[model samples]
Target: MTLLIETRELAVAAADSIVQPTSIRVRAGVPFTILGETGSGKTLLAQAIAGTLPDGLVARGEILIAGRPVQDLAVHERRALWGREIAILPQEPWLALDPTARSIDQVAEVYEVVRRRPADGARDDAVEAMRSLRLEGAGRKLPSELSGGMAQRVALAASRAGGARIMLADEPTKGLDAALRDGAIDLLREAMGSEGGLLTITHDISVPRRLGGEVAIMLAGRIIEQGPVEDVLQRPRHDYTRRLVAADPANWIRRIVPERFGDPVIEARGLAKFRGGRLLFSGLSLTIARGEIVGVVGPSGSGKSSLGDLVLGLIRPDAGSVRRDPRIAPLRFQKLYQDPPAAFAPQLTIRRALADLVARHRLDATRISDLMRRLRLSDGLLDRPPGAISGGELQRFALLRVLLLKPAFLFADEPTSRLDLITQQEMIELIVESAREEGCAVLLVSHDRDLIDKTADRVLALEGSWMDRDAVA
Candidate 1:
């Protein structure tokens, strides 16, 4: 196989050294993977390679594409190269796409802009991309119309259709179910293998293993381990790599999620939701008691987000009624989303945002401040705009704001999907503490099995149109 890209002693520094000088090579007809915990510079390294690193990020290293140095290329020049030779599937599907355009139009634009094609073949390719991803009824649908999984699939199709020789995918299976995740990995492996080269960046250990490729584990901005998938996963030499594998989200079921709080915190009977032409779920009966976390696990397109939306009243159920303590059900749930940056106004400081909420609700200010600190944030951070904070920090702030409402029921939808291992731990601990303090019932929706096993007392698996609820033993 020919070497497609090479990075020699690549070093990137931002707020300190995010990616210590590292070197790796990508050969055609293979999936070269970068694995690491969140905030460990995996994403940064991908950004550096793609030439889309955030401003103020200082990078030092040699990135060679086809034996040519690419660091000196202009932004537009890089774009031209990226569109035809490299493609990136960002971690956040919604953020990666435009909210206003139809899904088909967005995809068509990708082809037009990247392929520089005004030909009828572009539309044919776009539709084929959607079909390949199994995105039915998605061509004309807006990003908002599709479920989380559907939108993510559409994004993948767009990237694949770009026909780039190299692909960089970040957390590509984060919100997908086991089946869908496997399928996506297979699709990526086939595409890369058939045409030649692709590099995937993810915290998910399972991905590289299934794809059977060279794996490199990054930690504190360095490539700590690199080898074949079996060698690294089964006989990991690095301590950090071992830790990352041990904490794989798929293993969450081995640990026990304690039911320390007593009593039913939230109750619902025969809950059903119907919208457009789909039935999310019907006759869904369940109860969540205080000190108990129930995880709703399912594949994409199986209504995981829809279930959360029903409980939160973000979308009203057509048939079933939802009853929750008035004090706990906030119109806008804060803890469930990782990028609170996306929800906030760029001009509003964090302090003003929280203060405005407190003022509107006639709540005490001191309590809100204390909550923020407990979440590992500083009093000074409150003065900065949400955009100024990292994704993890924004998530913490968002969770704290929800806690400020002191809701009796917490509905978390894929709360850890975008978080690194450490942040995932912190957030889980915070959730347990808040549940214990308020005797609240927490409903968590996630694709990470390890997260479910460690944080939930019960598990519900949704497949196709069925939900099987099981008690955690």
Candidate 2:
């Protein structure tokens, strides 16, 4: 066995101080995992190893590849190593792909660039990889045209097509359903078996156990525990590891009585959306009673977001109608999008943003200030642009924006998808509390089974546009 990558006393910085400082080594034919809560700098560490850290952020450490220090390598040279010698699968699949280009062609370009082959041959390779991943018809579809899981599969295929000996993946299962997550894990394990060393950064504890390899649990930028998979998972030494395992909402939610305990605040019947020549859903019927937190779950492209839109009237349904109580006015049906920062104007100050919404909805200005306080946002964050705040903070602000409306029905689409574990937990708690406190009905959409189990009063499984009648009945 040989060390494919070695980082000695590696320290990463964002603005002025350190974020994640640690040392690790990647040995051939082994899977090395960086496990931690979100914002633990797992992505930063991967960037440091891949030599893709952005400017203004400094890295101090020795990054040795094949027994040679390559910290001083130029950007192009470092990037060249990717897809040829090394590769990375990022957490944000959509952002990773070229939204404007065909998914298959984008992947083909990777192989063509790496192998210096003709475009036709590279495309053939891309199509072959797609077939191997059980993705049919993906080769001709644009990145935006593919479903979430399909897009992710395409991204993975592109990363591996160039025979990259070392692979790094960040949160590969973040937004996928159980079935897709299993398929992705299988793909990764097989890729590692064929290519050698693999480094994956994930907050999901089940991932390490599934990979069955050497795992390093990180906390606050340091590896607190590292060992074989079974030994570590069976008897975790660190409190952080224990907390993560215990916090598996999927495990606890099954046994407790759901908190459906308040009033019918909102109703949707036969809601359906047709976009890009595909029917998302039709004749979908559901209701969120007062003080109820209902969760929608399914595989990628299951119409979760479309359902949210229908409930909020953000988009007109092609078929079924959505009717709400007279009290649930247009302004009262608030939405907190998955990407909160992108949902708002980047140039607008947070205060101005809230004020504009309040004025538009004829809300009292005092409600905005009180809502921010209730949402645990600092006064200092109010004047800052959406870009200045963290994803978690931005999401909190989005929630505050909704809270100000005192909405009767709330539509939250993958609201915690981009947040870290602690922040995700906090945000979920806040939402649940707010829904109960205000007697609001919440329609929560997420791929996280654990989240669904914990927060939902009732679960509605969406398979494309069709509801799982067996389960729902």
Candidate 3:
């Protein structure tokens, strides 16, 4: 197999250096993954290869695509060669997608740009790409109209449409449910047949294993260990790698056992929701009690997030009622949305947003600092706008904004989905501790079966608007 992408002593620096000098090679037909915690510079490395580094970031060292040096190429020159030789699926789909245009149009644009096809041909290719990704009706919807997971699929569709020999996917499955994730992995594997290869940067430990390829464990800004997936994941050589592997929910020693139930804090009865005149869910009902965690699990587009919105009164139910305790203030029921980037004010810096929240709530600086520490967010991030930070960091910051409120009832929609294994555990622990110590009732919506099994006192499964109680063993 021919080497597709080679990085020799590649380093990316911003206001201050982030990724240290790192060397790696990706070969055709092989899948290579770089796994790391949030802010480990995995995305930076991938962006360096794609020549898409942000404005302030500078790349040093050498990058070669198909044995041709690209580090010296002009931006437009690199972009001109991108689709034919390389393609990048960014971690945040919103960044890659045009918010005003329909999803299908954006995907069609990729076909036109990369393949230089006619308009009708591009549209046909776009539809085919989306269909392959199980995004049947997504083409007509604008980026804002699609869910986080759906937008992610659209990005994948665009990347696939480009027909690049080498694909660079950054957290491609960031917001997908288990079923969708499996399908995505299959698509990625199929894309990396004998003709091409894939280099993915993700915190998802499961991805590298599923792709059946080499895995590199990145810590801080460097790859500390690299080898075959099974060897690296099963018998990690570095302490950081071991810690990361152990942090997987499968390896965790502690579990959250449901304690005795308390009085109901929030209740939903005969809830029904519709989007674009299509029924999302109907006749769904659940109750969350004080100091209880109720988990909702289902496939993508199954209305799990809509249920959270209903409980939090973010959206009105069409045919049902959400009853909140009179004692609970409006702010006492908060929601941590799945799409963290969309949840914040794009114009506001993280520092400004947090400061406003703190001022309004009269929260103490020390308390906020401690919570940020627990969430593994750096002080430097506070200065950056929500768009500037990675999705995981934004997710943590979103949670922090709500945690400061000390809400009596919390609706967390895939709260930890964007996070890496270690941070997922930390976030889970934090949520559980909040329920135990602060008597905060939580509606935990996620597709992670292990997480639901471990943290939820009761589980509810959603299928086409129908809700069924899941027996917890």
Best by lDDT: 3
lDDT by residue (tens digit), candidate 3, 118-208: 9999988887788777776666788887777888999998888889889999999987888789899889989889879799999998899
What number of backbone clashes does candidate 3 have, counting pairs of residues 3 or more apart or in separate chains? 1
- Model 1, position 98, has a per-residue lDDT of 85
Q: By TM-score, how accurate is candidate 3?
A: 0.95
Per-candidate count of clashing residue pairs (backbone under 3 Å): 7, 3, 1
Give per-model TM-scores: 0.86, 0.86, 0.95
The residue pairs found clashing in candidate 1 are 29-196, 249-450, 251-450, 252-450, 252-453, 328-407, 328-408
**lDDT agreement of model 1 with the native:** 0.75
Clashing pairs in 3: 281-465
lDDT of 2 by residue, 261-338 (tens): 555766778777875556667778887887788889987766777788777777788988877777656677788876
Candidate with better lDDT, 2 vs 3: 3
Model 3 segments more than 4 A misplaced: 253-256, 465-473
What's the true lDDT of residue 195 in model 3? 71
